[model samples]
Target: MTHHASDIPDSFLAKWQTTTNVLAGIFDVPAGLIMRVLPGQIEVLVSSHSEGNPYEADEKAQLNTGLYCETVMATRALLHVPHALEDTHWEHNPDVALNMVSYLGVPLLWPDKEVFGTICVLDSKKRNYQDKYVELLWEIKKSIERDFVVIEQQRQLLENNAELQAALQRLTALQDELLRSEKLAALGAVVAGISHELNTPIGNSLLAASTLQCHAADFAVDMKQGLTRSRMLDFVSTVEQGAGILMRSLDQAAKLVGSFKQVVDDQSAADRRRFDLGEMVRSVLSELNHTIQGSGHRVHCAIAPGILLDSYPQQLAQVMTHLVSNAVQHAFLPGVAGTVRIAAQPDSEGQVVLTVRDDGLGIPQANLGRVFDPFFTTRLGRGGSGLGLHIVYKLVTAALHGSVEASSEPGQGACFTVVLPLSAPAPLQKPEVRAVRNGNFV
Candidate 1:
């Protein structure tokens, strides 16, 4: 909070000294000085040399009633006396004792309005300082203040950089935690769906087995009472019916288990291999069949077969699953019949465009843009975690090195198009340079 002119750097002192030399030469004064305000004294930080120059650099003077600098500091104004001996009030000033009777000075101020000192010139003979001289001194003072401005700016910049770094650190930690929470939530939802789907088929198979056991006991009793031809025929028909039910139930259970296992395995595995895009899409549909089972919505795929990719198939599978699931949950109203169509093809640019479109109550025009933003959902309190589209966006961009966008019109339908390369770009590496011994380096 407390600043003295002595606190100025040596570089600034050197510059001020050069300025004082120029000022004195222009004004043809015997001495020019840059004085600094200390606790109780005015100290000369720089002095200009001319013939008969009585003041030297680093000379100290008291700021009492008799000195011209004292008057400038007291009023915070310029003090100009053509000749101290001619002015009745300044005839006995301390400078008069050194035979320097003329004086011109202006008060210097720090950025905070605190007194720094005075910039002044003195003459051994009677001489007046012109307006041009005063103007020149003002310019020199401005140069010194400019340096102070730079110092303050650098200080604030350092402080702001520290705050920015701290904020970035906090954001990184939150992002990690959010990623963990989203994974757990997605896993929980998948497990619940798989459980629900397996329950029906397995439960039906158990019921049919119980019934078959009861029928067998009834036949044993009828045999002990001496079996009839009609009874025997009826028992054979009943046995055939029960066996058919058991077979269908068990078969359904096995198919559900296989589909669920395949989806879970693909999502967890990150292996990259050659795969057919059309087949991959159909596999994803099988896994999501349970989601749209009774929702009156059907998924149709028109992927170009033999369109192979050497990318992360599992991640692509997850992307397809989310796209279809989003359509089932958000594109249609309850009990409404609609069709979700997925089409994939290679474009002229060697990029594959996969589009998932729906014919249902489409998204509102206003919400189309924000649908991919994290935690942005119209069904917040319902079953929406609001992370599905956000996850899709990230996977397509970061993991797949692709881009995705959505377009929708209310009541017309919504479509999400993902554009990806058949193979991601290779990572950058430093180039190798070989020296050729023949004639020149290559």
Candidate 2:
């Protein structure tokens, strides 16, 4: 596993302890040990329970010393000293103090081929270990190395799992940020459209007031010069006509301003209330009139009147806005005129089936299933954020407690149908108050 000597698990330690005890009994030795190699030292990690064993568990000794296990580790092979006292090299070794002269050991290694330590048996009398016993120790060494492989695999899995979780969290945050930006952009478009619509009526009112002022000044001069009955009658006619024009123009301007304010409030506050579906639909279409006309497209609303809904009007309006905008953007090519129709009706189940259909280039069969997927847009890099329809799906299904689907045939047209309950389910908690800051949601 390429780990330090101190990283041994308790389970592996228990297994190694059993191995050491068995080896001591099989070899009929006083001491059987599993040693671990540390930096500049060697540790007795496991020791046999046999009587008269000199070595104890956790006993440490300085490295570079003439010990039997050190010779096995340094040579990366088996070592045997049949009679340490009679040998010229290992006679005065560290274990000689305990009268452990004979020794046999095999080097142990990690999965990466790094030194771990050694497994060995020591006795106080001179004796030679058979070749079969040496082979047995080697087999045990291989078993420990296999355990190291399993540990490394488990560590890698844990690391990979943590990384995946981090990536998922980052993706979620980015999606939220993009959704906020889309909402703010939609609201901005509505504001721009309303401003453009107000210009015509307000301009007409201003012109009418200026004309009336000029007419009154001319009448005063004529009256001072001795006005006739015919001239006074003519002046009266002009005054009546100017007054009518002023009233109509001012009234139209006021209505547009009022509608704009209502839409803005509904979208910003997201308050739940009972509202007429037909009227709400008309207002949303009116707010988007500029974008529709600018694209040479038309939107027709045939929503069933008196079909009321007790739901978040803001969320429903957002759904409508995105649906209509999606049609205007994707349902036709540039400068191509098209028709988008919105219809609604109440079903027997106390639900409303609202649809937005466009008679333009319909969606292809292959892409029909993926139209509502986030960031799935055919018009990449041409002002298509790919989130318009995705936002619609979210609002309908989540906030409004509804179901929505898309259907289309190539060159026929595309339709988005949403079925929503008349009375939405109560929210689990209050919604957050949202505001726009620097063209983004805050």
Candidate 3:
């Protein structure tokens, strides 16, 4: 509807003008018009003719008027004719009698659930207003519907974006909570292992102390009165036993503490170092021997003997340990054990390929993309924090300057390949940093 073009946006009013010109060419008609029907008036939104269109702007065609748009709106019916002048009920209007004759008009529904206007094509001479012409008007109505669908789609997309943002915030909160829970679980495992390590030495020391005290007192009494061979022998034996117990306890304590220190140092923020990759794998396997065996799993370590890397050894070990542990716990379906393969190979360009694969039921394709996402875990309750793979990815990409890729097919298996430098080759260490441009996706 329009009084002056300035009332609506220039772009909006201009759009209808273009539509009228384009539709006139496509329909092969003298004129094409779009009208907005109001409470007591009809307004022309479009009129393509340069000489001024026969369809008037702001002229209300009264209910019983013979004009096509007015009569069609009044009766809520379609009106099409070969010649408006020949139709007894329609040629009464001066506009039709003067020159405009053939006509086709159809309702332009408000798609917003309100009734709005009519879309029509007009010709000045007698022409065939066949059923195909009526069908042509219906097609134009559909094009109008297409525009409304686009608007509705954009509205729904914005609403979905809002919902997704809320979901992402909730996921971040859950990740913090999971980190706390993981810390506690790891702490408990450390405490349990330490207790077992300390018990064996402490118990032996207690027995040795008791025996040494009893034997020394007897030996001292015997020496004060008169020397005795049997008593001296007993004193020597007690001293030897006590010495062995003290040495054993010291040795066990030192080894346990050393391992704990190594774990801590590996995670420290320090310059990278070169280390033997093969030895690292062996050491991790030895430490987790009981766990592997208890779960009916075997450790297979064949890491090419002397492959070296200029990265943190302890961190790499942690990643491998977590992966192997994940395989043991979650690789297979319930009540089944699967072989977990771990291999490392070097290429010509000083790049190292480390592949870890499992012969167990694989991840679903829809979920494969999300597996490495922080806090995403298929095994939720059965001891999975979902951060192991996330940590692995971070270490490989930033710390080691490497790339990781994963592939899988349902019911087949999953494989994760990590490609890194054979040797960072004396390069200076640098901190990881990133810059954002138009959007911050990462």
Candidate 4:
């Protein structure tokens, strides 16, 4: 990692300052310094508190100026100048002007083998530093390198956490989008079913009306020719029969339309209201009638009456729709008959237990626990998006503040039970993703 002088914490710098002060006292030098390497410059990061030390902390000098610390950094090795005035090569170096003739310094390197700077002692008089002194400086260099390792690790950890957070946000966005699409798809299917169902009654009414129109015109023509008593009686009987058929057909159509309108309004608006549990379930089942009939499955609702709830009716309807739809789509085989039963009852704890059970092929034991997971479907490419149960799980737990569980016995049937409070809690600002264990949310 690239680092700057300012990146060094003050705590570490304080420790280095103490080290420099001790070194200066031991060496009896005028200056004991820890330098940091920068672009085209070298800085005195820590300077000793020894009396008469010329270099102060944070002092900078241009690099490649024949400075003793610069040479140590360039070679990444030790440089010991016993006497600068005595050596012709260093006689005109910058330290000579400061009257510092003797130098002993070691290069400091980071864990990545990059230059940090140098640690050294400078004496005003010529002195030959001992081997023990050089070894002690090398020990201090090792300690500083260890500090570099810790800093780099912390930097990498922070970067990794940021990346994980970003990925989680992205996953949440995609899940929301998929959830919306699934709802639209479900709504569209209901519309198609209702349209198909409306065809029969509307067609019957039209046929009856047309037949009555022809009979009325024939009666008028017969009236001009002096109609007989038996003919007039037949005309009155025909009119009565036609009127009854029209009333029944129109009444049936109106009922279907009313049920459709209520279900659609509740689901689309998603408004919270007090409603009868049995009535709501019947409405939802009415909308899903076409789907159940198409699958050759019979639905028997045994919901108790007078069980009212103050909650989001739309979300509850969705839960019912998906659960019933799941049973119809997965429970039976081709040309095989099955029964899906919905039952609900109110408990003493002001809660309701709603169940959807199918008497068809049951879920396998191994796959039972993972049925609620998103994008997990046995019928992958055969018209299953796999979000059906997942959405149901989210709605019950997060929005409705309830719990759902799935149970099955192989070759018998599958059952989904949902327990919800009579009054739902306040809605959350955002849906929470929860873990499911053993086919139930804990």
**Cα TM-score per model:** 0.54, 0.60, 0.43, 0.60
Cα distance off (Å), candidate 3, residue 233: 3.5
Worst 10 residues of 4 by lDDT: 260-269
Worst 10 residues of 3 by lDDT: 433-442
Report lDDT per candidate. 0.76, 0.81, 0.67, 0.82
**Full candidate order by lDDT, most accurate first:** 4, 2, 1, 3
Q: Count the backbone clashes (under 3 Å) in each candidate.
A: 0, 0, 1, 0
Q: Which stretches of candidate 1 lie over 4 Å from their true place?
A: 1-22, 36-38, 43-68, 75-102, 106-116, 124-271, 286-294, 334-336, 345-350, 364-412, 424-442
Please name the candidate that would achieve the greatest lDDT relative to the true structure.
Answer: 4
Looking at model 2, the pairs that clash are none
Q: What's model 1's lDDT at 306?
A: 90
lDDT of 2 by residue, 202-301 (tens): 7887888889899899999988899999998998898899888889887877765543343223233348899999999899988998988889898999
How much lDDT does candidate 4 score?
Answer: 0.82
RMSD of each: 10.8, 7.4, 10.7, 8.0
In angstroms, how far off is 217's CA in candidate 3?
7.0
Report lDDT (Cα) of residue 52, candidate 3. Answer: 34
Query: Candidate 1 residues 15-76, lDDT tens each?
Result: 87788888789889888888887777878888986677888887898767478888888898
